[model samples]
Target: MRLTSAFSILCLSAALGTAFAASPVHTSGHAVTLDLISGQGTANGGLNFNGGFKGSKTFTVPLGSVVTVNFQNMGTLAHSFVIRKGGTVPTDADATDAAFPAAYAPMKVEAGLKTGMTQKVTFKANKAGAYYIVCGVPGHAMGGQYIHLVISKTARTASFN
Candidate 1:
């Protein structure tokens, strides 16, 4: 009876360990995991990343730090993750094409993932300001597929003279 009990406990421990390992890590060291998903709503068919829109719509990271985005497309259609140099998040429908380039003429980083696919995108947060993360696919960003990313300056200690 004692031997059987010990074996059962060992099996249970292994199962728990596997579950924890498969779970997504929010922030691994300096890298942040951003999970992107599409086809959230039936009416507008929105997009979501890292539990935003219904949760937190803002992502904060340290300036000049390396950020990793784990993008996943859970929708039936393909999607892309594109970071532009701007602070405003567009609200109009199918206005991504005209509004995106007009405001953020130059894009910082961009990545694309097909339907039911995942990708890892790593970029440095060199700038300290608010940036807009949107779907590069046409009509996607305007369909409410965008989030605000705030890059804060590193904390520093001041010395009095």
Candidate 2:
């Protein structure tokens, strides 16, 4: 009877540990993970290219938190990660603009490739609002290939909505 009770307690403890570690990311508390992909748009094909061909996604994080993004570059050509300031949108949907390198945050990975590559970066979610994540490739940011990361003041309460 004693041995059986001990075994049961051990099992329960292990299960609880796993559950605690598996908690979903929150907005203002712990660090969250963001996965992003980079590539070219229709403009790359040519000026005559009619169809848009770009990839992007937005992620939400908590205010004053940390985030880890496992980004992948799955496009033909070199690409880079650039965090731009708010309210600096381009007039052309596919136009490129110059960003402040000093203010821009870059996460280094292998040179962008068509086959795809992965890079992990961690940053503080100091700003409590919306921000843009884009590829520094000449015209990539102007394309639809950009992601919006919104940091809120609550824990695990962020959503694309």
Candidate 3:
């Protein structure tokens, strides 16, 4: 009877594992595409990304995946997007030095990306950890325009919160 009970428990655990494994995280091959908009809402005095400010939204992608960010400036102010190493909002406004090389907008102006424009930045998630996507424009991220980003070692697909 004890052997039978053990077998039943093992089978149940296996079944549960299989059920969870069947629903893998979705991904676009080995790529993750994301959209980010500046000043979609009246948050943080309009210093926001995708209507979220102060790291209100978190994005995650699998390690080694090529990530593409489709960035748009819909706000009234100049804004630029950049990927930085830390999650802390930088006290300074300069956010151009990206943690990962090639993880910044290609058409970024010194002032910022002008309002009513769009740009794209692509890079590989080579590290597994937390990061921040912030505005590279002076005084923009310092005013509160950034979001949390994470590269997961175990994640099979990309997701956002």
Query: Judged by TM-score, which candidate is best?
Result: 3
| All candidates in order of lDDT, best leading | 3, 1, 2
Poorest 10 consecutive residues by lDDT, candidate 3 = 18-27
Answer with 2 or 3, whichever has the higher TM-score: 3
Local lDDT at 8 for model 2: 93
Cα lDDT tens digits for candidate 3, 1-161: 99999979976875586478632123567987777787776788778887777889888889999887887888888887777887556644343568776776645534777788888778888988988878877677778788888898998768767
lDDT by candidate, in order shown = 0.53, 0.49, 0.75
lDDT of 2 by residue, 1-161 (tens): 99999979976875575478632233333766554545534354421111122323445667756676555555556555555544655212211331223222233312332335666667676777756665555565565445565667764544432
Q: How does candidate 2 fare on TM-score? A: 0.56
Over 1-161, each residue of candidate 1 has an lDDT whose tens digit, in order, gives 99999979976875585478543324434555444444444434546554344224666666655666666666656666666655456542222442223322113222345667766666676677866666666666666677666677852211000
**How should the candidates be ordered by TM-score, best one leading?**
3, 1, 2
Pairs with steric clashes in candidate 1: none
User: Where is model 3 more than 4 Å wrong at Cα?
Assistant: 1-26, 93-96, 106-110
Clash count per candidate: 0, 5, 0
Q: Which residue pairs collide, candidate 3?
A: none
